[model samples]
Target: MDPVARQTLLAAMDAGWADPRRLYAEASTARRLLDQAREVLAQGLGVRPSEVAFAPDGPTAVRWAMEGLLHAARRRGARTVASAVEHSAVLAPGRHRATTAGDPSLFVEVPVQPSGALDLPAWNAALQVPGTVAAALQQANGEVGTMQPLEDAWDACRRAGVPLVVDAQACLGRTGAPTSYDVLAGDAQSWAGPGGLGILVVPEGTRWALPGPPDPDGALSGPTRHTPWVPLALAAAEAWQQTGATLDADAREATALVDALRAAAAALPDTEVVGDPVDRLPHIVTFSALYADGEAIVREFDRRGFAVASGSACTASTLEPSHVLAAMGALTHGNVRVTLPLLRVAGGRSEDVARFAEAIPAVVAAVRAEVGAPRW
Candidate 1:
């Protein structure tokens, strides 16, 4: 979290400790804070305050958003169309829903180009499928940082009479909120806010419903089964304000740094830098080195005092091959993913990226040498 956001969070802990559902004075104060937080987030996202709903986290927000759309459209069609490179949160639930319904065709996974951009023709064709009730495409690929053709996809979905749910968790604060989505999902953590807070926007007139049975308190459609923690909401609001204030400047610097890192990685022997170089996230870069183990590369980078990630960005803890890379026909092994922090945040500066770029060639060589892999 940003230092200022952290202080705001800590201060909120004292001010918003009461449950907002109660009718006490402290509860009223907490309720006011929560409402204020929603307004802040809505303003930042360019949506109405009534359109916004909170979630426990980003993945949950995505899953709920997709499921809600699917449920609402169930009478019209049972199918959901999404790009193959969608985050696991979107893909996993989609697959599960298809499996549970005993219909493989219920979820259609459209392919992407090698640059990790969705295949526009394939996407349009998928939406044209008879049973597609909803379509999903991220504003940007979380794993490789490739920007999707959101406007085109939105137009296609509109023509097909399908609602589009955009997972903008990766682009929210870093790039800016996307305007093309019928339903937009984002994470507070993406903008220097604390984790455990997710944002969902459902514009007025969008066909959406809570996926499960009705809640007595009508709370299931909101952040959690109950009211969200007031302190976290306030902290997220503060983070959004702070991050948005410096977004343009921070993105400019991060773009230059990421470009340098991409060049360094691309220059390494047998290494392939993935994603669209110019039409991608400003702060993320991923590269794969042939014949090198991803974990070994991560460890080598860690030993050199730089934290990095490998395998699937969403499922890194499981060390699974990246489905995103596989969909893009890119090497999945020995991959290193870097997401630069905002320049205003600690350990986020030009110097940090420079040091990491300086070490890339040696790190790749050292890892490949240990694995006894040819560098050709």
Candidate 2:
């Protein structure tokens, strides 16, 4: 769905364009408006305003949060753990092992089912390993819309004394992070905010070590007295508030669309819909047509004027299926992701999803025909 919130954001930006950190009266007004935004975020997410800090975008937030967890591990011991479903930004840094020559690093990944949620048995086994450190999990799947058993898995981490780092990039404003996690990270763009904005929230009393370009004074990214990046500050607040109000409606529309799409998908000879059929996000659908190159289908739909995402939209062009989908051990290489937004009053209607659903058959059919799949 198209978003009207863009207009709202543009207008807000026009009005509050002054630098929020400036000492002058105009900047002071921007700063005051930012405070209310932070309070809204705190209220919406059930955390204090001090816990949230804004970053450039989702990947940046993911990196920052992972770094904090890694620093926490260094303070306590020397091991780090995560899941197979983690985003690339989180997994890449954790792969390097420090040795006697340096600080060796090692990683253990909890497996997931083909539907993309965590594999409970595999997870329990991984966390039980000796010298287990922090664990990372995503609240929702950007590729498949499957939700990990976060509260349960996070409770396991807590019981094992392993701090849990969560990627809430797809969950913030839709399904806010569960409070049990040690570190929370997400991008604002997924929720219709500006592209270059993300949030990293550290709860009080978490032994996170953040020594970097943004935070070196033993404080968060913002200075001790004031914060920077107030537009993100405002985005977080407004998006969450708007999401809470329209979640049910959006979910209702998306569910029906998914049901229809799943029925249409099943007609294919060797294809399957991945992710939980129930208990998942309302906004996304992921499926794989066996033996079809994902890029081919992506191009077919792109020509059809349907803007679909292949894997996580932002990270897909790296010539790999999402780690989340790969971790699920499903049909990874030939998958497509469909997303619906919490649109504004005039932006989209149920018929739009239906039309998109109707278009999918033609798109897939064209792709299959082009690939020489037998027309049965």
Instruction: Using TM-score, give the best candidate's number.
Output: 1
For each of the candidates, give the backbone clash count. 1, 6
Per-candidate TM-score against the hidden true structure: 0.95, 0.87
Q: Give the poorly placed runs of model 1, Cα more than 4 Å off.
A: 212-226, 312-319
- Locate the minimum summed-lDDT window of 10 residues in model 1: 217-226
Q: Per-residue CA lDDT of candidate 1, range 112-210, in tens? A: 999989899999888888988888899998878999999999999999888999999998889978999889988899999998998899898888887
Most accurate candidate by lDDT? 1
Which pairs clash (backbone N, Cα, C closer than 3 Å) in model 1?
54-223
* Tens-digit lDDT string for candidate 2 (308-339): 77763233667665777667767775577887
The TM-score that candidate 1 achieves is 0.95
* Stretch of 10 with least lDDT, candidate 2: 217-226
Global CA lDDT of candidate 1, please? 0.86
